[model samples]
Target: MADEVKLLGVVGSPFVCRIQIALKLKGIEYKFVQEDLANKSDLLLKYNPVHKKVPVFVHNEKPISESLVIIEYIDEVWKNNSIFPSDPYHRALARFWAKFIDDKIVTPSFKSVFTVDEKEREKSIAESTEALQILENELKEKFFGGKEFGFVDISAVFIAFWIPLFQDIIGLKLFTAEKFPNLYKWSQEFLNHPTVKEIMPPRDPLFSFFKGIHDKLHSSSK
Candidate 1:
């Protein structure tokens, strides 16, 4: 019997996109169930009761929560296309950078772009720029995995795709080519990949979605 594989996710979520990218890279056949996060379904609550979040990966009726965990699970199960390096040390390094990207880059960058308070936003922008610089310096190759799209690249899916939308929406330029040449170049290359291109959210609608949030937050802050 064939395995039952399903992904519970919301549209335009970068975390969810990470799973989609990994699945596509590994050539996995699965079902994508779109979720309305505002009114989360019973399945979502049942699968991930603690977070009640999307991007719950279900394989053979077993549910997996968290994007990074699901990604590692997918990599382990599907051996054909290995996402992490073969060497244990390299794999550990990749994981380290991924964690750093999530903890240091993602939070500050999002706040730098979306926060309503001017002072807080400035602080976030400084921290975000510092994080980007570290990432840029670490990037010594075309892609994070040297030449191939691998673990670290997948971990940084947001920096490549979503951040551009955020920048455009708010007219804030924290990740410019002049400021971080390597990362800027990496983002362009990453976006051009066929698999990455397939799953990226369309600019107009996604922009509108983000804009709505941006306006709402700013208005509420006032």
Candidate 2:
């Protein structure tokens, strides 16, 4: 029987984009159900009762939550176009960087950019920059997982697409060719990938939406 795959995702969500990239890379045809985060759906609540979050991957009546986990699941189920490296050591390294991106880079960077307090924002920016520098060092080649785009590359999609929008919204620049040359080039390569380019949201709407959130955060904090 063919697998019935459906993805519940929110627009402009980096986490959701990870799964989208994975599905696209694996050539998996699935229905994308957009979720209104303002008012989550009953299906989202039912599938992901704990987090009630988007990017829930439903496969043949079973539900999988968490972006990374969903991505791994997709790769495992669809054997063609493997995302993880076949070598054990390289695969471990890929997993390590993916986790580091979530913990050290994405979390701190978001806090740094979105926080209303100046001191907290500065601290987070410094931490995020340090983390990014580490990633820049790791990308010694065209892609994080060597020549081909794989797990680590998919995991870091936020750096390519979303961070630019965040930079415009917050009026601060964290990523630049001069500052992080390797990552800047990698971002360009990642964004320009045929599948990624096809699925990316328009920049104007993304900027407006995040700008509204930025304004709300600042206003509420006042």
Question: Can you give the TM-score per candidate against the true fold?
Answer: 0.97, 0.97
Ten consecutive residues with minimal summed lDDT in candidate 2? 161-170
Q: Give one digit per residue, the lDDT tens place, for model 1 in 58-123.
A: 999999998888999999998988999999999999999999989887888778767888998888
| Residue 54 error, candidate 2, Å | 1.2
Residue 115 error for model 2, in Å?
Answer: 1.1
Clash count, candidate 2: 0
What candidate 2 gets wrong by more than 4 Å, as runs, is none
lDDT agreement with native, every candidate: 0.90, 0.88
**Collision pairs in model 1:** none
Best by lDDT: 1
For model 1, what is the error of residue 210's alpha carbon versus the real structure, in angstroms, after optimal superposition? Answer: 0.8
Q: Tens-digit lDDT track for model 2 on 1-222?
A: 988999999878899989988888888899999999889999999999999988899999899999999988888889999999989998888889999999988898788768988999888888888988999988998988788889999999988877777777777888899999999999999899898887787889888877887899899988
Candidate 1 has an lDDT of 0.90
lDDT of 2 at 129: 87
